[model samples]
Target chain A: MNIEIRKASEKEVPFLVRTIIDAEKSGTSILPYEKIFGLSEDETENILNSILKQNEEDCELSMDAFLVAFHDNKPIGAVSAWIEALNDVSSSVIKGNLLRQHLSMKNLINASKYWQNLQEVHFDIPVKSIQIGLVYVAEEARGNRLAEKLIKQQLEVLQKKINQKEEKVFVQVYHNNLSAIKAYNRIGFEIIETKENLDKNLLGVLPDTKKVLMQLINIKNE
Target chain B: MNKTEVISQLTPIFQIVFNNPEIQISENLTANDVKGWNSLTHMILMSNIEESFKIKFSLREINKMQNVGDLISLIESKK
Candidate 1:
């Protein structure tokens, strides 16, 4: 099968959103929105409509880049990254505060906080890194290394984008998703931090969602 | 490591991870080909490999391994 990973187009939003929602774990539901933020269905459509309406702003806003993997023009998987420029400019304080409020549920709260903090870390510094979030490969395509391909493409894109200031690429994986953690580990990311007390880490929504935060601090220079 | 030696080392890992003595692992066998190679078991397998081999594996290599053959190749390269 011919697989291509590229910048997702506006038309692909509905399909991509559906794919994401379908692939969601029973624990969490994926709500569509601009740049793939997990929010309520009502919030997602409102954001999508606004984005569609402002298509001509020529806005070079550096937000998260969402790339989809297409096989024979069918969307099968997706990966996302935060634009370093936006990471630098965007205010993470609100998100951080929200996560802090949810700290009672150690796992989910900590995962949220870790994700938010990493975004801030990558944004504050000129780190040529990609925050790999929402990586999903169709179940039938699980063993085919499609996730690896998506990650390789993500690294390639990040490399080209930061050619001058080039350094390394990185991603975050959930603590409980051992399969994904193992995969990421195989790909060269190391566990920089393990959030044990998920309850007191972020906005306490639920008490069961535990996750590990990993990073690829460096890559071979070859 | 020799292929036989590698398999010998891996046999215990398989037994522990899968909890099935009937499992006869060959170079071509993969998690997909096995009955209970879910994500949870996958981690157990990886942890076993790490503990037995005394070497850490990166996420990239862990995700790319498809079978016993692939695992052997990775171990050889690391050594």
Candidate 2:
């Protein structure tokens, strides 16, 4: 089957949002109100509105890219990436210089706390790695190699567009998602960090849930 | 090896892994039949099998394995 990966257009934000909600329903199963990012209709609308607003201004909080996978003109899956500024307030201040030079000073001051609180990973390396946020294959479309196809196609596109040697790919998966973890490992992603403690913190906020984050690093092996 | 030989070989592994006496295994036996076959237990089983068989399983094969028969097939292929 021919699978096509295309940039999610502004017109398709609703569809993308819907797909994410449906996928989260079967995928995460997080209880309502306990969800960090609400998945309900109105909440999804708010999220989409924020994304659209950022897109219109070309000033996103994070370097974001969303793509949708389709087969025979029917959407099957979607994936998104965001380049996070792990740390370095000075660098972020410099980077924000593009928005407004006058606000650069204020931006630096305001962003200091946010940037300071930013979760630190391995950032000494030259590679500007991205955190894969959303990777969802429709429940019906799963297990037919569609997930593999979607991921491999995206990897190929990213490799061609980005410097593979300098860019590392990363994703967080729940430790219980054995199949997903297995598939990711088959695609050459290795577990770099296990956020077992984060699971406990999340459980406190969530009341009852056991979600462990498994970080996969796509760096070249030594 | 035939199915019985495969089962006979796997019986000891299952017995030790699950700590169950008189553990019965068949071509269709799966983790669902045994208690404590979660992710951690699965890792232990995989490590033990790898050491015993002197063969490592890729994450793909490990995840796709549904029963003892699937594992036997993977082991046979390795040999």
Candidate 3:
């Protein structure tokens, strides 16, 4: 089987958005927008597509930020990585879009409560580092170390583009997602810290499920 | 080698890597089926399998394996 990993093109935005939604549902099972706003799959896709479209104009969530894995010419998995500071800006845009989508009063309250709870336990991401997020491997394509491959490839690309000072890279995984955490660990990432007491009321997850922050420093060697 | 022989060789490796002697593995068993058989241990398991079977797998071959049965088939083909 021929495997190709490359930056996603604008034509693949719809596919990337769908992959992200599917990955969020299957991998994490923590649907922040879905649970709060009762969004259907199509609704979520529309929102994400709009975000990607906007990204083309301002790069808030550009396709270049994503790397798609194709096996035998079929897309099987994807990962998105960028500088941490970009996320802070893109998140505000996402939240604005959510509000403009006219979320109900009850859902608005729920979103507020969720953000409050998240803010309490959130860790400040380290500066001068590339942050990896939205990691997903197709359900059937799992168990083959595709996630590790995607991560390593992204790291290699980022290392050449950035300076020597910005050598650290990090990824955040849900504490309960042991497989993902373990995958990152095998890729030389260490658990820097964990943010506890994530608001599970809206997410409908177990109380023990916490968000973990893991980092891989010194990617030059690996 | 037959399926039973391959499994018999793999069972001890799984036990040693996962630190669980009672781990029962079947052809259809996956990472989700076995406790502590996560991504990190999965790599270690792959390395151990390669050493035991004296076969090396490419990244494509490795990603294609979905379960013990798939792995056993790959091993058989390599041999």
Cα RMSDs, all models: 19.8, 21.7, 23.0
Cα lDDT of model 2 by residue, B8-58, tens digit: 777788777656677888777655455544322344456566777788666
When 1 and 3 are scored with TM-score, the better candidate is 3
- List iRMS for all predictions: 17.1, 22.5, 18.8
Cα displacement (Å) at residue A140, model 1: 3.0
lDDT-superior candidate, 1 or 2: 1
Taking the tens digit of each residue's C-alpha lDDT, what string does model 3 give over A1-222?
Answer: 467998887677877886667555546455655764566667777777866655531122456778899887678888877753332222222224323333344544444444434444445444346768678777778888888889888777766666454567777776777877787878878888887773455347322347778888544334
| TM-score, per-candidate, Cα-based | 0.49, 0.49, 0.62
Model 3's chain B TM-score?
Answer: 0.91
Candidate 3 residues B1-79, lDDT tens each? 8878888888898887667789877877755456444333444566667778988776446545556788788888887
The C-alpha lDDT values of all candidates are 0.52, 0.51, 0.64
Q: What's the ranking of the predictions by lDDT, best on top?
A: 3, 1, 2
Give model 1's DockQ, 2 decimals: 0.01
- Write one digit per residue (lDDT tens) for candidate 2, span A1-222: 577878776665666666545444434555322243223457445554444434421112122355777888877787665443323111122123222212223323333322211222112211245445556777667777666566655556666665564566666565666677787777667766653334333442232233333344553222
Candidate 2: residue A201 lDDT (0-100): 33
True-structure RMSD for candidate 3: 23.0
